[model samples]
Target: MKIKTLAIALCLFSLPFAASANPTLLEKTRQEQQIQKTHNAEREAGFKLTEKEVRAKRNALIAERNRLQRETELLSKSFSKNENKLAKLEEQLRLETGSLGELFGVVRQAAKELDTEMAFSVTGADHSNYDAVVNEIVAAKALPSITQLNGLWLGMTEQIQASTELRQVSVPFINGEGHQSVVQAYRLGSMGLIADQGYISWDGKRHVATPYLKQPENGPSVSVMSQLNESGLQAVVVDPSRGVMLEQLANSPELKDRIEHGGVVGKIILGLLAVGAVIALFRGVKLMMIRQQIKAQLKNPTKPGNNPLGRVLNVYSKAQNRSVEALELRLLETIVDEQQGLEKGLSMLKLLAALAPMLGLLGTVTGMIETFQVITQFGNGDPTVMAGGISMALVTTVLGLVSAMPLLLAHNVLSTQADNIRNILEKQGISLVAEQAEKAGSAA
Candidate 1:
């Protein structure tokens, strides 16, 4: 009974502690539930704020879409209205411009044709101010005014009148040397301009006349111009093709230009020719003198002089004591020595004659190579590109032929003279030996 009472007491005593523990656990549970409630309230508030913002953005987007649709509808209606107005205006324009349109078209076409013709016309050089009227007609968007039509007719009339009239006028001129000056020039009725110097070409764009680089043989001269000015009825040469033939004459190469085109080989060939000519002249003069000396010696063989035949006679005199065979050998040797002096420059002349043509051939080969290279680089489309090389080849060949001919002629003449001298020496030597042999035999 006492133990049970103690246990009951202990239970009673533990009841307050258990009650305190329950209160503590209840406070903790309440604190945890308060934290969870605060988190849920904060999450709900944030969701409501995001929803409001999204709703506002959606409303704004809906308004923007409506505004864009309204603007698109307005633009479409305006485009349709503008298209209808443009079609109406075009119909009205078509109805109002019926035959006038054709007339304007004809005028424009005539203006275009006239502009093209006038660009190449020599008369345009003096009447260049008419270009503005022509351009106005060509570029006119509407029908030409009566004034413009009259201006066009006036331009055509001026061209016709200029084509028929031969007049002299002071104009700006550029010479072949590229000097610009104001000079008195004769206008040959749209044919060409003739300055005091020569034929001058018209530059319609620059409104100036330029002289031809090389004037034609029968071209205008100062005497002809003077007569024309004095009489106004002189027969003067005119280019019927306006400037075509004149331009060709101006571009034609001169002799010096052709020589330059032959390049270094041509110069060398000419140099060789000069050298050969000098050699031939010297040798020819020397041979002539020697021949005269030999003739003199032939006239007076007994009196030996200071010459080839004289020396030979002296040898014959000295060798008279020797046998006939030995004397004959000695005379032959002396003739050979004279022959060597006579034949001095003949071989060099011959060599120069031979080498000139060979050098010309080398130039031809090099020029052809250059031509082929040009063709390879630029193709054979333009013939002028290849003309340089072709000119070089032909000019070099001509030079070669020219150089070789005279040298060859000189060589032949010189060789013949030397041969004649040698023959004379041989005959004289034989005669002297024969005379010596006859004397020796008589003495024996």
Candidate 2:
């Protein structure tokens, strides 16, 4: 009974509390609903304002696109109209120009020619402004101006005047040693440039002159040039082909340069020639001395000296008392011995002569082989690439021929002398035999 009363008391207390909680919950729910309504109203107003602003921006962008399109069309029509007008004007200009068009073409062509000519002309060193005027004419987009035409005339006139005038001036110069300096040089019209050295090459671009590495052998000497400078009437050598002949002459190889190009084969050939010359000289002198001794012995046959003829005469004297047949045999033996001495070096000389040409042929073959190798490795577009082997071939052949000729001639002359001596000895021996036979007959 007590537990039921406690439970009833607890229910009564919870009922009042539940009633109070319900009123408070209702008020709070109403307040939340009112706040949500205010938020919805504010969101709707913000959404409406954002929608109006987007529509206005879209309309403005569309209007701007249409305006740009209209402007593009107007500009395109104006461009077409201007293009037609320009074409009509150009056609009218062409019709009115008539011979003037041809004149413009001729003027441009002449300007181009002058520019090209002046680029290589030696007078360019003195007058360089002419090139600028001619270049303006060449590169002109419109018709040449009268001022430019006058300048062109003046340039041509100046070039002509300079070509006729011989002037001595201080100019930039490069010597053979490649040292650059300002030196007094004479401009030989358009032909060449002369300094203390011989002919010098002109550089039109740098406006400088450089001496040729090698001057022409037949060209004027320094003394002659100095005299010409001092005396205007003195004759000076000038290249008729302007600088072309001078350049060729300067680039041409000298004797020493040719030999160097000929390489080892040429040197060998030269060495062989030298040796052959020495041998020939020695043999010639010995043979000449032998011939002299033989001639002297002939003049006095009785007195025997230490020469071949003296020995032969002595042999004859010893054999005089013997039978004629025995004496003849002794004289023949002595002559044979003398013949051996006289013909000692003749064979060697002949051999050398024959060997020289053969060596030259060997060099030719080798040089040709080298040239073929070069051709195989590199195509023959440039002749200078093959010049080395070709030079060796030609120079060696020349050296061989030059060496062989003199050697062969010396051999021939020496051989003739030797043969003549042998003939003299044989004749003397036969005469001795004849005299001995006659004496024997007289005694019998």
Candidate 3:
């Protein structure tokens, strides 16, 4: 039994060795279970890692969506701001294109016209903003502001007011000889632009004062325009029509020109005046001498026939023997012959005085006809051609009137003197004839 028990223990020990030779089912299953447990643990660990990765991806998606939403909001705000800006811009465009645009057009037009006016206007030339303002206005797209409009108004008003005023300025002058000089220019409104009594033209491109070809005799004399005061000049000359009217007046023919233009008719009138004056002088001298002789002869009645009264008395004495009727006839014949001598040259003087005016009229008619002829040929275009004839007409008329008045006065004086002498002779002859008749009666 002990052996049997030992063998059984051996067998038990050997059986454990024999079983260790091949894996036990429980051990294999445990091993398989351990491997499965390891696989499961590894899978769970991998799944937990995958879950962390999945969470990270989900968080990234959420973050991306949130960022997209924020960007959308910002874009909407930007669109809203852009729309408001466009609405305001449209309103501004409407305002600019409205009546304000028309007003700008009017202002620009006025500025342009005013600029031209100021260029020729003497009064406001020194204070004009014409060129700069015109350029500014031309480039502008919008209406001018109140300040700009006020400047325009002032420019226009000042120009108008300045044109009416007289002001002096410094200027460069060009003479007829093409010489240039500086001067204190005078602007006498519309009358003339003068400096040192010479006219200047403003219509030319060069702003140079120019002298007339023939200056006026009565220039802007110091006597005409008072001497300049200490404060400023009293007056100046300005050219409205440039130098048209004043130049024509200055170029008008003078007295020397008149004689030249008056031609032959004018000379004839002058000759008559001269002859009438000479004859008057001669007649006056002759009458004075005759009166002296007659007055002396009256003192001594015996003095023979030197003067008219003396001759008549002598004739009556010589006719003493004849009857009263015969004696009267002889006295009448002698008085008539003496009257002829006293009235000598008086008729000629009167004729010349009357003829002078008629001749002048004839000359004037001829001059007018000549002027018309020139007009017909030249279409009245040249004033210079017409001026000569006009001058002739005026001069001849003036000459005729001047000659006639003096000649008429001279003839009247001589006639009155001759009449007085004739009356005296007649009275003396009558007295002498009556004495002779009385003597005859007494003798009978």
Candidate 4:
């Protein structure tokens, strides 16, 4: 009974310990639940305030949008009123300007034409104020003021005066070697640019110096034009056609350029020319040597081995000092033999001269044939298409003539030298024979 009473006392003390360990089962649980409920209520009230704030912001945006629309509408109405006012002002301007409107249009059109002309003209490029004034006048709804018109007139007058006047200026140019150099440039009455190097011209935007393709005969004379630009006393030949002639010349082919189109025929002609030149040179040197030896033999008359005259003298010496008639016969025989040697290559040279032109003719025929072939294949629509064949024909013919003339001249010269040598030997031998005959007569 005492233990049961102790157990009941322990149970009563343990109830408070259990409640302290588990707050959920005690008064603390009830207090925590109440705090949670109050927090939930506060959160619900905060969310409602947030929703109201968002709706208020949306309404503010809508009001701002409506305000902006009203401002746009007001601006459009103002713009319309101003546009009407501008139209009325422009109409009044037209009435006030009267005939000036047509004049303004005419002035603008002239300015446009002038701008184009000046841009292409051989003068300074990029018109500054002139361009702006032209644009303003073109876009204008009314007639220009007097000052604007005056400026336009003055600009045109200045351009006119400048076009006729010569001006010298320094500019960069590209030479033949593709190097840039600063050269003195002359503005030749707004038609072309003349420079020290060759020809100069405006490339629409900037002045560029370009050389003539087929340089004019006095092409470089234009370079001396620098002096013309600087001094009045300088005398020089002037090309009135300026770049026009040069451009045309550039299209025309030169001899060397023409030879290029002659094809194999031209090559053959050149080969023949080279061979003829070699023959002429050889004959010249050989004949020159023979002439010198003949001169020495005429003076000495002792050794007659190396030269024609010496050989003739040797024939006379081996004549057993025979009768005048017999020695004369031997002299004639020796002269005949020497003459053959002296005139060795002359005939061949003459033949070469004759054949060169014939070969050229052959080339011409072949070239014509080729040209006709081209005509057969394609009608004569473009000259360039048949240029090669035509060039070959003409070039070969020219080459042949060029080669032939020189060869002919050389042949004539060599032949004349040989004939002179033969004549000298003949004269000297005859004189020697007569002298011997006179001595024999005196002894007899």
Candidate 5:
């Protein structure tokens, strides 16, 4: 019984110790969780406090911004009005600074109008009294008003003065100074005066500067134009759109004479061609006569003569009683002689035909040499100057070919026909001789 009681007491005591140890561990865990909860609450309280302070600050900033915006609007309106008033005052001051003449000038320019029927007459005592004409224009009431004529007087003065200067200028551009310029001025002035006015009529009453007029005949004016022979050169008049400088052409002796007389080479070549044509015409007439004679001989076949076919026929007739072989030999000899006579100058004609192209080539070479000379002399090297030589060369070549080709053809055709006719005559002669020889033999 004692052992049982001791075991029971020990069991009871161990159970209570185990139970107490578990409760103590639970209590420590509860303490740690309480500390964590306290720390979280404190942190949350601190964050809420900071958020409230920020909200208050933001509200105050919004109120301040609204107040500033309102003030800025009021200032902008005030500045705009001040700026407008200042700009107006500045414009008024600038207007006061300008002179009355300048103001009148502006108004006149703005109100001026153009009228078409304005008369512009140019009258000067000779070419030297141009100032009188300008003074007349200045005094005329037909011009624009003075206020509106700010530049009008200056412009009119220049125009009339320039017109007079141009009229007094040298006629052609022969001299160096005031040559082309004077010519151009004269031309433009004449045109301008005509356009500004209605028409231009030169007063025949010239001043002492001009000589007396030479009255022309009432009848047809005789042109002392020598017929210029331009055989080698081909020329065509170019119709210029701008007016021709006819006055200069009329005045320049050298230029006028050149136009009228043409160049030496052209004249010489033309004379040569004319002579050649005359000779050819005579030859052609002679050839026609020869052809007629040949035609008559062909039709009759009985005309006896020393001519080419005629001689051949005569030889054949003589050998009528002889053997055919002997007659044929005689006929052959006669035909040969006739052929030589017919072909007398044929080689010369051929030589002439061949020489045409060679002459053209010579012309080409000479033209090129001239072109080179021009290049060497002035070195202007203008294609227009060089083109003259080139055109001459090409024209000569074309002329040569044109002349030679037809002549060569005619020579060849005539020679061939002559040869054929000669051959036929010889054949007839031989046949007649052969027949006669055969008859003689048979008779023997």
Candidate 6:
């Protein structure tokens, strides 16, 4: 009976313990299974969301692609429309080509038919009208190119018709000054106009338009000169020895009459200038004379008042007994006087020398003016006409320099001699006074 009770009690304790463990284990297993289910649901939801977003993005991309396709189609259509417009323009140009050419031809013909006289009556016809004509020819589209030949022919035809009408209407010749000229120019024929001014060809070569003035078999030759008229327009005979045609004319007898008159006037003016030059040179001559007198004094020691040095020596001789202070004062006075004399007219000489250059400059100006005048009267057709003025200009400059150089040398030499004489006078005066003092003191 005791063993059975013990066994039953042990069984009862074990049952409670097992029952508590069972509930706890059940709760743990339920928690773990619930967590697993929750995780699986979350994973499925995430995957579904990802698929949804991907599908949405794909749909958006498809819509965008459709929109781009529509834009591309519209752009292509626009390009086709532009191409059609260009094609239409090109076709129109092709169809109008003939008509435009015919129109240009008619315009050209009308331009040719209209006389310059009629155009003048209409007024405002000039180079601008000609340019319009040329433009019309250019735009004709008849030929592949509006060649120079075609232009020449068209220009000639128009000019002939216009000139003929102008001649009939008594039109005046036009000059550069906007006035009528006396000389009448016809065509560039051998008989009518002498020659057109030769032009530089396309290859930079000179092309003489007129065949009448042919080169001599040997070379170019000039004719003898005749005198020029006061107007400077007459054909003066020229010396054949001269190289150029204009030079011969300039040296012509007719030109010489005017030039000689001018030369005489120039000479008269130059004579006055020469008188002034003489006056100026007188200063130099005086200096030379003074120097010569000094030399003469040295050659003949007996001569009095010949040079500053001699004068100083004479003064010292006369005042040998004087005190050094007095002697020095006298020497200083003598030196002042001598210096004044030596420098006499030097200022005037310098002024004259300076004026020489100025005169030369004046000559240059006058010469250049003359050359420019010739150029203005005629043209730069001849260099020979200009050489005389150039020569005069250069000669004047040379003369100026030649005059100045000698004057400069003379001034330097005179200055050096003056200083030398002054020094000698001073030294001699000092010695003479000092010697006299010593002699007097010793005698006393």
Query: Of the pair 1 and 5, which is ahead by lDDT?
Result: 1
Full-model lDDT, candidate 6:
0.53
Q: What lDDT does model 3 reach?
A: 0.77
Model 4: CA > 4 A from native: 1-116, 124-152, 164-189, 193-198, 205-242, 252-255, 261-263, 285-289, 292-296, 299-305, 321-333, 373-378, 424-444
Name the Cα RMSD for model 3. 32.8
Highest lDDT among the candidates is held by which one? Answer: 1
Worst lDDT run of 10 residues, candidate 3, spans 222-231
lDDT by residue for model 6 (303-403), tens: 46757768876776666677767877777788789878767665655665566666666666777787888888877899987876765566565555655
187-282: candidate 4 lDDT, tens digit per residue: 666666677655665565655565665556765445476566568567544556545766787778776778788788788878888998998899
Candidate scoring better on TM-score of 4 and 6: 4
RMSD of 2: 11.0
Considering TM-score, where higher is better, how would the candidates rank from best to worst?
2, 1, 3, 4, 5, 6
RMSD of 6: 20.8
Where does the lowest 10-residue lDDT sum fall in candidate 2?
Answer: 217-226
Which structure among the candidates has the greatest TM-score? 2
Cα lDDT, all candidates: 0.88, 0.84, 0.77, 0.79, 0.51, 0.53
Tell me how far the alpha carbon of residue 218 in candidate 1 is from the true structure, in angstroms, after superposition: 6.3
Candidate 1 — worst ten consecutive residues by lDDT sum? 122-131
Instruction: Residues 209-328, candidate 1: write the lDDT tens digits.
Output: 777667778779656877877887877777799879977875778888888999999899999999999999999999999999999998999999998999999999899899999999
Q: Give the TM-score of candidate 6.
A: 0.34
Pairs of colliding residues, candidate 5: 323-437, 324-433, 324-434, 324-437
Q: Is candidate 4 or candidate 6 better by lDDT?
A: 4
1 or 4, greater by lDDT = 1
Model 6 Cα displacement at 93 (Å)?
Answer: 55
Off by over 4 Å in 6: 1-307, 317-322, 436-444
Q: lDDT of model 4 at residue 6? A: 100
